[model samples]
Target: MRISRLRFPVLLAAVSASLTLHAEQTDLRVSPPGWWAGMASPKLQLMVHGPDIAGSTVSVNDSEFVIEQVNSLDSPNYLFIDIDIADISPGDYELTFTKQGKEIYKTIYTFRPRAANSAERQGFTQKDTIYLVTPDRFANGDESNDSVAGFVDKADRQAPGGRHGGDIQGMINHLDYIASTGFTQIWSMPLLENAMDDHSYHGYAITDYYRIDPRYGSNALYRQFSQQADEKGVGVIMDMVLNHIGSNHPWMKDKPAKDWIHHNGEFSATTHRRESLHDPHGVEADQKAFSDGWFVPSMPDLNQQNPYLTNYLIQNAIWWVEYANLSGIRVDTYSYSDKAFLSQWTARLTSEYPNLNIVGEEWTTNPVITAYWQEDSYRADGYDSSLPSVMDFPLQDTLVNALKDEETWGTGLVSLYNLLAGDFIYGDPYNLVIFGDNHDMSRIYTQLDESYALWDMAMTFLLTARGIPQIYYGTEILMANPDTDDHGVIRSDFPGGWKNDSIDAFAQQGLSPKQTKAYNRIKSLLSLRKEHPVVTQGKFTHFAPAEGIYVYFRTDEAGKGAMIILNKNEAENDVQLARFEPVLKEFSTASRWGNSNKISVKNASIEVAPKSASVWLLQ
Candidate 1:
């Protein structure tokens, strides 16, 4: 086992204080295990754990490395050593531990080299379409690691919430299929170790922050997968949980500090009142309950107010970005953590990797609440979370409502126009992650009540509208959870993921007519975004919904652009071009985006099919 994992005998077991120990027979554990020599910050804090290790003196023989301080928490078994690694050579360095004037232990620590231009790596932008996947339900490529020992959540294909044996290898095997679908980025659910007995497949309730779950694959395999993904033109984004962790985590039994967890590690449910953070009429107790309460009985909310714990989390995130070569991060439960710590966390991360993007999950349909968590552009309170982006929950809800509601003066497509009219509240609307549906909600096809036409219309708007687009796995073939909104069913196993599966979505075998059409529609539109390029960066201009016909134009600086027309009318509608003449007059020729047919844009009125979308490239 690598020293980075901090592998050692269980720290919960009692041990004799006077027992003699050496490198070969010691219970000591150190993290991160290794660090890069060159970083924006030179200080590295090593959390050392063992029996009676708190009072030991740490020393190094090298002059380049300096031990800043040794801090002993309330626990007698842990030591936090702060060291300066500025300009240190990339190699192994030995450190000795002495106690009571006697040499007790010695170990070698390593410093690694940063990959070329790692600090300048670019993050996902509007040009990239993100594919979200539920890892354990995505595929099962490694049968050997199906039910790893000590992890009670064994693979049970019949159980909706049970582990289905998907691993990093499964994703690695299907990179070509994903890339061919016109996706430029992949955002998988939490890939960290969730050691719970059941439902550990989601990867959200992390047990060990540094170790990847053995069931999924080793840490080495994950890093290799990310590097390989880059070769296929697909970037990787890690889903991180900063609010809480599994109750079974080792820290629950052997805490480094008394206040490491909120409410003394007991269960106190959070009100989930994110608006309380900035609510004008909220009480202090309600705000405290929302920020400091546990998410659930099995998930212990972390106390980021503790400075030591805060440093540990900040360092852990930086370690993963460096180790896995990540393109971005999606923070789960963004507003649940301490406000002050979140600001510090994001500032440090962005400072270290200036070009990296970090999007937080603030699930609120209120644009005002979501905008408060982003950078200062849309905020007036002078409080900055330093977050680069946030999920567009308002727009997602609006889109779904717009598609399903009956067309009326205030309902249906008009709701979409009204919601987006308030986009000015968002600091950078283009940076928000817009999606039809995610793992937490019913599938987009299901949300549209299984209407193939409505689903395709939603896909067209999602792909060509403002902001970056993210599609859930299996949505290409129009996967849906019709009977229920159970997350397990929503994140059901993908077809052809297992070898003996009856169907193969990847191979395009045994698909219904609607499924096939939906698949083709998504691929065609996504490819248009890549081919046209203007849609990703063009200025958005839209006409309010009128008579069930809505039109929007994506115009670039060169006056070249694309036009998206969505029609909800049950009968064919003639969309008058007079209102769009200002933008459409410049272009006399137009071609269907997903098809090869060329049409004239100078027509006074364009005939649009009933409940269909018309996308055209203008020239």
Candidate 2:
């Protein structure tokens, strides 16, 4: 007879001491591993990390099940077991574990069906506009659960710059507001559990990937949010982080092995040399440093090279996708993980979802480096990737340059002109995700020095240009935080998030005339995008950038074409009729505002006002 310690508290019946003594005690828990919080598979992993849990039989809903792979995961106690389902069928299941034919522990497993592919689901395609919202800062529907037990941080709903009580239910309650804004999809930051004291508000450093943050809501509440989004004709994109975990995560205290984290003991910061990872002639030292470096000592980097760790991370992502019925996934710090592991992760996810979209955050301006990582690019050096979309950092940089750089040959708006000129470098230029600003960077309004016209022009081009578009939260209202550069300040609370607040952007109750105009302009622009597919799926053509007067066309064979004229000059410039003739053939008339009767276009010189952009429909 083998001997084992009976440490856990148990209330056993006095039926047979032999069976109780012979029974195996199984300790099972699953996480996305350190700092890695999202995966794409419709699976949950119960990594048995202590004793011989294999002898402990597993069952789903009291039905017998199979446990594969008795492998160790770098950590001595870890025994990886996968929990999978056929198709994304929604239901509740009872997961029970029995050792020596005696039931010991059981838990509930709830799976939600993935959303059916529709035009709403197509919001992830290269054609739709995405509005990124941080629910905690966006709006607050409940002020009751702001403070919870085990979470050290206190609620400061009054602190404008501090964390307010914005839960998943709050977002769910305002689906109409989001849907009405003409945004087809909402990508919220991580809603996973983060019980850490100081930085729990951001939700990046996740403590539990499977469980929803209590302050945010329960796992069931998240599913309700997803369902609500679908009902409102909007898709949901989960914001995931695969780079690191919080210092207070349970795994940090009871790590399965010593090598589960990179440089756990001899911790050193990474060089953040993103280019070096894809460098053809790069040295091993450079590669290791980039991949192994900790994002911050507080956030521990995961060891993805370990087989168990890799499987755990990948499966966690899938579970959420299927569990929440997510339409797309937006990965945080796309270049921070092991490149080989990322390739495998993307391939598996796309293979499973097929039409599902995954956008990575590779914030680099060099198109070659960004393009090389995209799916189906034939790399000269033989590095393979299956990533579907990448954040268009080059175009974003060029756009900023267009607004700030003085008009010069091969510079300024010409930089933007030249950037689009190289669309041939991309496999599907339309697949790239374009954005002005995100949660990490400074707000776009601050970057443009509070120029409303410049911000509007950038928004127009991003929406009309050939690619998927993502707008940062509060951008529609021209929120700004300059010089300070504090991300918290930039991600300030929404005007009416608190129960007792004055300004209400959600209802448009309190607003200056200019602010209301900005809000209405964005709402109308997004509505236009939803109403017209010519802007989303039409072919893109551009004229040479001349003295800050940049023009582009989105035309299709159905005689539907929209010409966008952006005038950045201080003085209004007379646009030559010749500049419009090449693309506006046969259609000798145009509608300046896309609504009025078509106007004759015979040798007519149009004057484009300074600091404004106009979209005219050609007929």
Candidate with maximal TM-score: 1
**Per-residue C-alpha lDDT of model 1 across residues 1-619, encoded as one tens digit per residue:** 1222232232112222333445433677788878887899888899987777888899987877688999998998888999988867776666777779887766667788889999999999989999999999998989999998898889897898989999999999999999998999999999899999899999889999999999999999999999999999999999999999998899999999999999998999999888888877779898899999987899999999999888899999999999999999999998999999999999999999998999999999988998888786556567877898999999999998998899999999999998888888777888989999999999999999999989988999999999999999999999999889898899999999998889899898988888888888988988889888898889888988899988998989897799899999999988877788888988887787756877776756778899999898999
Off by over 4 Å in 2: 1-45, 49-64, 73-77, 82-123, 158-161, 594-597
Question: Which ten contiguous residues of candidate 2 have the minimum total lDDT?
Answer: 1-10
What is the Å distance of residue 74 in model 2 from its true position?
5.6
Worst 10 residues of 1 by lDDT: 7-16
TM-score of 2: 0.88
RMSD of 1: 4.0
TM-scores across all candidates?
A: 0.95, 0.88
Q: In lDDT terms, which candidate is top?
A: 1
| Error at 165, model 1, angstroms | 0.7
lDDT of every model, 2 decimals = 0.88, 0.76
